[model samples]
Target chain A: MVLVALLTGGLFLPQWAMFIVTIAFAKALVALGLMILLRAGLISFGQALYYCLGAYAAGALGRFLGIADIFVQMLAGAAAAGIAAFILGFLLAKYRGIFFGLLSLALSMILYGLLVKNETLGSTDGFNILPSTLFGTRPGPAWVRYAVLASAAVVSLGLALVVHRYLRTPLGRLAPAIKDNEIRVEYMGASARYAVHVIYVVAAVLAGVGGALAATTVGHIDPDMAFWTTSGEFIFITILAGTGSVVAPFAGALIYEIIHTTAYDLSPNTWQLSLGAALLIIIVFLPQGLWSLVSKMSTRYARHP
Target chain B: MRKVLVALAVAAAMPAAHAQSVKIGVVTFLSGPAAAPFGVPAKNSAEFVVEQLNNGQAPAPYSKKGFGGAPLEIVLLDEAGSTTTQVTEFRNLVQRQNVDLIIGYVSSGNCLAIAPVAEELKKLTNFFDCGTPRIFEDASYEYVFRTSPTATMDSVGAALYVKDAKPGVKSIAGLNQNYAWGQDSWGDFEATMKVLVPSLDVKTSQMPKLFAGQYNAEISALLSAKPDVIHSSFWDGDLEAFILQAGPRGLMKQSLTILTTGETAMHKLGKQIPDGTVLGARGPFGPYAPNNQYNKWFHGGFVAKYKDEPNYASYQMAQAFLGVKAAWEKAQDANGGKRPSNEQVAAALKGSTFEGPGGTVKMSIGKGHQAVMETAYGVTKLQGGKLTVTNVKRYPAEKVNPPEGVKSADWIKGGFKAQ
Candidate 1:
C-alpha cells in the first residue's frame, strides 16, 4: 500500500514536495543503515565513508564511463562500498562503543582528506553526473525524479522486509543478544565479533546504495558527502527514528527534511537553533523517538476500538 | 453586464500595463561560510538595483522605466545546504513560487547543478557571480547564461598584471582553495604565466581545503618556499582569514601576493592588503572599473544607499541586473508595447551586448551560449589609512578570455591564439 501510494499519490504532490520527499527517501536509506546497527546497539559515526563511496562510484560511472542506466550505476556503487566495508569490517568489529565510532570517523575523514586534495575528482567542489535514465533512455529531470522516487519506495520497503525477517533468524536474533551481553553470546559458541562484522557490512552496502540514489537524484556530489557532519546527520535521523522497526528511519528522515527545510525557509539565519530545539523536544518527550509515539497511538486506538 | 465582462477581459489581458511587476527569484547565501563576501554583498547589490529599477532611478540604459515598464517584484531565497537542497529550492522557485526568472548561487557547484534544472524547468536564469568555466564548457543551454567571466578570466588577468607590473619576478607559487574552482584557476594562471614569462619557475603550490579558513601551515610553507610572487584565488572568509594570518607573519614582505578576485574584500583588508600586492577584480569590477557614466551611477548609488563602497560582487550584481534589464527591454521592443514571454527574453539575451556597470557584457552565439567581458587589474597601495587599488588597467575581453570550447590550459599552452 505504501509503495502504491508512493507511485500513484506521489505524482499528485507539488513539484517541490515531490523533490523534498525524494530527498527525504534518499537520506532515509542512509539512516536505515544506521538503524540496522542501532538495533544491535552499535553506532558508526563515519557512515559518510560508505555514503561518499557510493556517490563517487555512481558519479564516476555516469560522468566518466558513460553508463547512465540507473540500476547498473546503483549496483556498481553498492558493490564498491560493500567491498570497502568488507575489508574494514575486520578491524572495526573487534571494537565497540566510542572506539568504533571514533575509528569510523577517522576512516571517513581520511576519505575526505584524499578527496579534497585530488583535483581530478573535483576535490571539494566535486563534479556533475549525467542526467538520470530509465534503462537506457534519457528522461526529463521530473520523470527521472519520479523514477527515483518509485525505486526508493520499493527498495526501502524490500530492505525493511528483509531486515524484519533477518531479525527472526538465529543470526538475526543474536544481534540484540550481542548488544545486551556480548560475552554471553560468545559463551553460547557464537563469535559476537563475527555477527557484528556481518551487520557492519550490511549497513555499509545500504549506505552505499543510498548515496548512489542521492547522487542520481541531486545530479551532483562532492567531498561534503564524506564530511563527518553528514555522518552526524544520518545518526541524528537514526535517533529521531528510534530502533523500534525497520520502517522508523523512513519516517524520521521525512520529518527531519520537512522540519529542516521549513525552519530554514522560516528563519534562514537561525535555522540551526530551530533544528536543535526540535531535537531537544523530541529527546525530552519521546526518548525512543517518533516511532515509539506511533506504536503508542496505535495501541491506544486498538484498545479503544 | 456585457460591457463589464469586456472590461474584465481587457484588464486580464493587459496585466503588464496594469502594474504586474516582473517577479524574480534571487538566490544567494544569506547564512553560510561564504555569506560575508560572496553572498551578502551580492544580495545587497541585487536589492539595490531592483529598488532603483522599480523606482525608475538608475542612470540611462538601466534607467528603462522598470524592466521595460514592468516593475520588478523581487523574492530573495537563501542558498545554503547541499546541492540537492538547492536543486529542490530552485524547482520551488519556479514551480511553487511561479517566479518568471531566477538569479542565483555563489558556489560553482550550485550554479552547475541549477543550470540543467533551470533549463529543464525552462526558467530564464542569470548565474550572478559563480566563477567556474565548466558550466558553459560542459554544456550549452538556451535559457542559462553567466553575465560575468569565469575564474579563467580572473586568473589570466592576474597573470597579465603580474607580468606587466612585477617585471623582476622569476619564481611563482600558488595558494588556492582545493576545489575545481581553485584548481582550474591555478591551471589557467600557471599556464598563462608560463606563456607570458617562460622563465617564471614554480617554487611551491598549495591547494587548501575550501572553507578551512585557517592557513597557518599553508602560510608557513609559502614562507619557506620563498617565491618572488604568490598567486591566490581565495574568496569570502577564507581570503579574509588568510590576510589576517599572513599579514602579521610578514609573508607579504617577502613576496608580492596576487589576489585573483581580490576586490571583494578590499574594505575588510584595506591597509592589510600590503602596498606591493597585485590584484584583479575578476573583471572590470569595483573602483578599478572603467570611468563611465554607468559606473558613476552605480558607484555613487551603491555608496549612498549602503554607506559602503560597492565590492566586486556588488558591481557584478549590477552588471547582471543591467544585462537582464537590457534583455527585457529588447524583448519589449520586439513585442511592441507588451509583455514578452520568458522565451522571448531568452531569445533577446542571445548574442546581445549590453553596457554593464564596468564595461560591455556580451554574448557570443557560437560560443556555447556563454558571455565574455573585459577584466580590470590593479595594485594595492596604502594611502589615507586604507588600501586603494592604483595603477588600474583594463584588458580587452577577446585578448584575455579563451574562446568557446577551448580548455583554458590548452589555450594558454597554444600561446593564447598565435605564435
Candidate 2:
C-alpha cells in the first residue's frame, strides 16, 4: 500500500488518486467505528448520526470561532460527538442485534429531521467548511495530500494494534462471550450493559474522527451524513470486510473505493448495477470476503506440508 | 348542556379576527443532506425578505403595494421530504391559519402534490423554485402559478448556450441527479442538441441518485466517454460533491463542462471552477447583464437591503413576490383600486408579464396550472477564486414550452440547426 501511494504521488499520477486515497482512509475510519460495535455484538445503524455530529461540530466551530486549525476542529468535533454518543448510547446499549440497529437508525433519523427543520445549520443547503490549516500555517496541496495520507495510515495501523491488544484481554473475550451467551456472562458476574455502552461510545469516537477527517477531505457537511443510507453503508463496509481483524474495514474501504471509481467510469448510469453485481458475486462466492479467502488459501497450503 | 352548546355556537358564529400582518406560507426541505444548499438559502431569503418587507422601507421592486394594503407576514413550514407531508401542511395552512396566499415550495414533487390542494381550497399560490415540467403538464387548475421557468425552459437555454458557444461540440455526455428535474434537464438538452447539431452524438448519459456523495465511478465513466462536452443539472450538495471530486480529476479541463444550474453554486465554488465552463441559471441570472432595466432595479434594491448579492434562489423567491405584486396591481387597476377577489387575483397572475430581477417573466397557464417563465444562460469562470458567471443570454419562455394540451413525449424527435 505504501509503495502504491508512492507511485501515485501527486507529482507523478493524476491528482484523483490521492483524493480517492484520502476518501478511502476516511471511510475506513467510519467502518472501523462499526467494527468496534460489532466486536461487542451490537449492530448500529446510527453511525451516520455520529458522523454528521462530528462534521457539523467541526464546521460550526471552524466557521463561528474563525479557528481553521484542522486538529482543533477535529478535537472539538470528537469531543462533541463523544458527549452525544454517551447520552444516546445509554438507551442504545440495552437493545441488541436488529433492535439495536433499528433504534439507532430511528434516533439518527429524528436528528436528521431536526437539522432539516432548523435553518441555523443551513438546513439542506449544507454548511461550507473553512479551509483547514494545520497548526497555525496553511499547508500547500502536497502537504495536505501527505497529511491526509498519513492520518489514514496512522489511524488504520493504530486502531488495528489497539483492537489486537484489546482482544487479548479478559474483558475483550467477555465481549464476544456476552454476544454468544449473555446469561452465561451474567453468571460470570459481568454487566453486559456497561460493556456494550463502553463499546458504543468508543465506536462513536472513532466514527467521529472519521467524520471529521471526511469533512476536511470533502470541505462541506449536511444532514445526509446522519441518514440511514449512510449508516447502511457502514454496515455494507463491515459485511464486505468480515469481522476478522481491525484492518478488514480499511481493506474493504479501499476495495469499495476502487470499485466505485472504476464502476462509475465504466457506465455512469449502469454503475450501480455493476456495484450491486460485484457485491452479489462476493456474497455468493466468498461469504468470508477477500481477506478470509486469503486466510483460507494460506491454511490450505500449510495443510499440504 | 344546552347552555354550553349555545355559548359554543355563538363563539363559533363570530368571525375570526384577521392578524394585522399578512401571512405568506414558506415551504421547503429543512432537514437532511440535501437541505444545506437548497433549503437553507430558501429559508434565509424568506426571513430576509419578510424582515425587509416589514421594515417600512417598502423596497423599490417589492414595494408594500401587494399585501391588500397591509404589512406582509411569512409563516414558515417544513415540507420535510414527502408529498403526503406537503399536502397535510398545505391543508393546515389554508384551513387553520387562513393565509391569503402561499409563496414557497422548493421541490417539484412537493409543489405538484400541494398545488391541487391549493386549487381545491381556493388559495392563491406563487410556486417558486419548483421546476418540474410535469407539474405544469398534467393539470389545468386555475390557482397555481410558478414564478420560475420549468426544467424544459432552462435546459433548452443550456442547449442553446452550448450550440452558440461551442459550435464544434459533439458526442455529448451528461450526469444528472436522478429525479424529475435532472431527468427533464438531460432529456431537454439531448433533444435540443440533437435537433440543432445533427452530428452531435450522445456518447454517455448517467443519473446518479441525488445525494449519492461519492462520484468516483460515474466520473470515471464520463471521462472515458471522451465527449467534447458534458452537461450536469445537479443542484445543492450533489453539485458540490461532483465538482469537488471532478475538479481535481481534470474532467472539467477535458470537456466543455456545462452546469445547467451552476449559478446556484457560485458563492460556494467561487473561484475553484475551471475557466470557460458554461454555467447558467435555471430561470434568470440574479445579476442581470447591461440593458435589462428590471434586472438593474431588482439587483440594486436587493443589494441595498440585504447587504449581499442575491443568489438564484433569492432571485426566484423575489420573482414570486414580484409576480404577486404585479397581479395585485393589475387587479387593483381593473377593480378601481379596490382589493380584488381571490378569483380576480388568480386571473391577474396567469397570462401576465411580471418584471423579475433577471428579466420579465410571462406566466403561461399550462395544463396543470403550471406557470412557465423565461430562461437565462451564462458562462462560468473562477475570478480570484470565486465562481463568476458572464455572458448572460435571455430566451423567451414560449420557445421551450411543450406543445400545448399534449403530454411531453418520453423522447423528443427533431433535427438540429445551428441557431
Residues A61-168, candidate 2, lDDT per residue (tens digit)? Answer: 777888767777667767877999899878987889899989989988887877765545645445556667876887775466455555545555666677678777
lDDT of each: 0.84, 0.71
Which run of 10 residues does model 2 chain B get worst, by summed lDDT? Answer: B410-419
Model 1 agreement with the true structure over B302-353: per-residue lDDT tens digits: 8999898888888878888898888888898999968888899998888788
What is the iRMSD in Å for candidate 1? 1.8
The candidate that achieves the highest lDDT relative to the unseen native structure = 1
Task: Give candidate 2 regions above 4 Å deviation.
Answer: A1-305, B1-20, B51-66, B288-294, B304-307, B333-337, B367-369, B384-386, B406-419
Q: Give the per-residue lDDT digits (tens) of candidate 2, residues B77-190.
A: 665533323454465566555677898878765665566556656788878887766566645677778877667767777888788778787779999865456666787788
Structural similarity to truth (TM-score) of each candidate: 0.94, 0.55
Look at candidate 1 and tell me the lDDT of residue A188.
97
Model 1 superposed RMSD (Cα): 3.5
Chain B TM-score, model 2, reads 0.86
Candidate 1: list runs displaced more than 4 Å. Answer: A140-142, A302-305, B1-19, B211-214, B365-368
